[model samples]
Target: MPAFAQDSDSETSNNTMKNTEYVTFYPSYGYQDEGLWRIPLRVWVHKHGGWGGKQLSKVAKRVVRNKAGLEELHQDQIEMFRFRFRDFVADSQSFEAIFLRFDQDPDEEVFRLQSADGDKRTNFNGLLFGELTLTFERAEELLTAQQSKNGWLRFTATGKDHQGEGAVRLIKPQGDSVISDIDDTVKITEITEGEAVVMMNTFFKPFQAVPQMKALYQTFDENVALHYVSGGPWQMYRPLADFLFKTAGFPPGSMHMKNVRLHLLEGETYGDFYRLIKLGSVASEQQKIRQISEIFSHFPQRGFTLIGDSGEHDPEVFAHIRNQFPEQVNAIIIRDVVNDATKNPERLQGMKVIQADSAFIDADG
Candidate 1:
């Protein structure tokens, strides 16, 4: 018999809530206490507002009004369109609580979460986002659950009329780990190529992995855990996971990302839309620092190899992180994206720099 079996089967198949959608995300494992493993549960509940031409037209018109402001307006339209329609569908439904359960385990249990506590779940401030990140306590039994060879354990989440599957990677406190950046380092999103290109590559184009990076990641033995820390908002987690782990064949690990919510703009100006994008860009550096610091602090006994690209503030951020946790951070690798003849020695003063084109052979030799 499974634990919490009653709660797992409690939600009935009611007619009114049949259209709900649940998107389960990669959850992070917390520290172990007296035989219990701490697992942070994350789930998104919304209405499936399918991608339709009418929705696109409505959003585009609200964003782009005249040709005089076409360029900036196009950028805003792209942002609104990508967020408002694809993947992230701001639901009209309001949920005060939800339930989650581990899959493929004989003793799997269901956990209930409330929305009153802002950090544990999305309060009124994040109601528009529908992202609930609640922590599960005394969950040590989960460690015995079946896990993929790379340490990922599967789980199912359900709320009202929605249901979905997600996984969490269990890592020990003491081990070698790799903390990689998603953007220019592993996946190719040209940050230095301006907003239009960034939006195009992120939303429209197929995601491409940096050549050799996947192979480099696979070289790590079982004792070495993996993690992906990025400035990209949590909304992009599903697509990014599919591209990196499923398609590119990189090992699965914990995902740490910025909490950003995008809602359909009602009577909002172009300046308002543009400002949100700008704020996210500026906050990227700080977000990475905070997330990486948390990971380092979470596993104080684990040594980390930080990987990022030179197209942005990665070099500076990694350098700062190393300064804070000099003992735990074993290496800081900056992938050279900026084309400087001298390898930009001053910019990459303290880190090991690699060229994307030759990183494989370079790392192997």
Candidate 2:
């Protein structure tokens, strides 16, 4: 059994515990205990590396069945910790200590912890290699300590090969589904001629969704899964993720984009094949439709709605979906762009196509 240790110095002791241990804790404001709010303390452990250089013990900790389930972590009432490793130490260090405080109101169940309480302290004797002594008042006192007691202590540490650390917080949205677009959808004002090519080179400027679109997004974020499928390069994934969460208020979800390179070369180069198949511009869109179909097929209980502007091939792609899976598609809302909306009259005859403003009004109603 590995041992844990806590900081010994009184000055550092009052501060957050930054030491080599099995578990560390951090204070979370949103999560509460017995009326006291607390933070999550990520924990790390050492394990054997398995096949393909994968760490086997870390994998075991993430396994659902054993003792690693997210629910199990909450149920076991285990203190949360953050894991870290150091090149010199050759062991992991867990920082912070978190506990749950319960609320008296049965109807309003709440949990909290006093992370800043000066009274809280831990000790490292070196004998208990990976053991820790975390002392705190009962759950009810957590909030009181937060107000009257010393502020919570937080610590940072360096690590070599820290494992079994960090807790997973499950974020459950209330809305049913999230619908979005690609190209100029979250990127800058591109996806169209004239200004499209110019906007491509100008980076750093944030690519945000229109305000009205965000307002619409607030309507169905809780239950539905959000998806962003674009005809852009897969390299845009990270930047797009940041833009969506930071600027556009779009939650992370399944994102499909062009393969760029397929299993087998269709021509001299992948770009050649992409242009030959007219896929360079709409590859992600096709992949997105297939993904939507797959998701709807598996989850029949949830209804899906598609949203996009008619600037690009959205009309053609969405039309294909309506023809193929009319039953699965509850509604198709397309924002009119130029005269494309009028041109697709044949496709919009049966499906639902409305201007952006009109859709917002209907959503508000």
Candidate 3:
């Protein structure tokens, strides 16, 4: 997910509509075997009742920078962040209704769901998001056989108020999956750059990727499954997925991104173990450790090669998985984001995880 907010499936068109509505299937990945496979689908609703331009306050006009302004790049990034914040403040809302439709057929023919959980649906801005657990049995086998650019099948989610689509990528029982981070690994998110990271995300600017990382990914792209795991919010799922294909030239696979949840977001700040918690809500900011562990657990027979960066807790998280399921994880590649990458060259030398700087990617990775 570049810009990390760039979502190919999450957002609606840029609009000044008085009332905006949208739906999305976060993660864009699911799993099925020989039985009834249930995929969790979340539907986000945005209802706004004012001009889009009115969403931003007067202060933002002075804050958001012009293209040729001083410290242009940095200012643009800050402006992007402010733009997102303004959107969050203005259009972001919690809502629900009885007629939340999830179907794969364009004409509502092959697959459809009329009602979900008795229809007493509702949503909240932060904690109470709406969700539906889609179930399937023998039909799953038929779906597994179907093919498209992204995954096994494409699903359409339509509410009386809004409609959207997402790819339901499946996890196979007997195959290889390469699960890796997007930011700072495959793409140049510049996480360490702090506030300056937003510029690459705004206004259709071309986002960059890590050198040779694409080639490294392409090496396995032919005969393996690619799962993108990232810290980017699911709100940007659409453009993010789009960029992965057209810009990065990576094969289509399932996406696992952040869900904006207060506890999970604040846990890191409060030094709490919220990242370890993994139940209850259908949509919430799932900590990477718990989410990645779930993926490993989902396909015990499948071997996974974890790739992430030293920019955050990816090294620690991937290392933990490697230690726990050393056999399932084929390799752990950690790309250095900090300057002093060689401070402890001897550390983790005996393990399968390889920590190399960006310069050595194509040559070593």
Candidate 3 lDDT by residue in tens digits, 223-323: 47777777665544555665677667876766766644323222252122122111212232236777788777778898887877666666667777778
| Stretches of model 2 off by over 4 angstroms after superposition | 1-175, 186-188, 194-204, 261-285, 354-365
Backbone clashes (count) for model 3:
12
List runs of model 1 lying over 4 Å from the truth. 1-18, 33-35, 50-85, 114-122, 125-150, 261-280, 340-343
Candidate 2, 189-231: lDDT as tens digits: 4444533232222222335565555666667635356556566
- Model 2: weakest 10-residue lDDT segment is 79-88
State in Å the error of residue 317, model 2.
Answer: 1.9
The lDDT ranking, best first, is 1, 3, 2
- Candidate 1 C-alpha lDDT tens digits along 75-108: 6545444443344444423443556676665655
Candidates 1 and 3 compared: the better one by lDDT is 1
- Global local distance difference test of model 1: 0.61
Better of 2 and 3 by lDDT: 3
Q: lDDT of candidate 3?
A: 0.52
What TM-score, over all chains together, does every model reach?
0.76, 0.45, 0.69
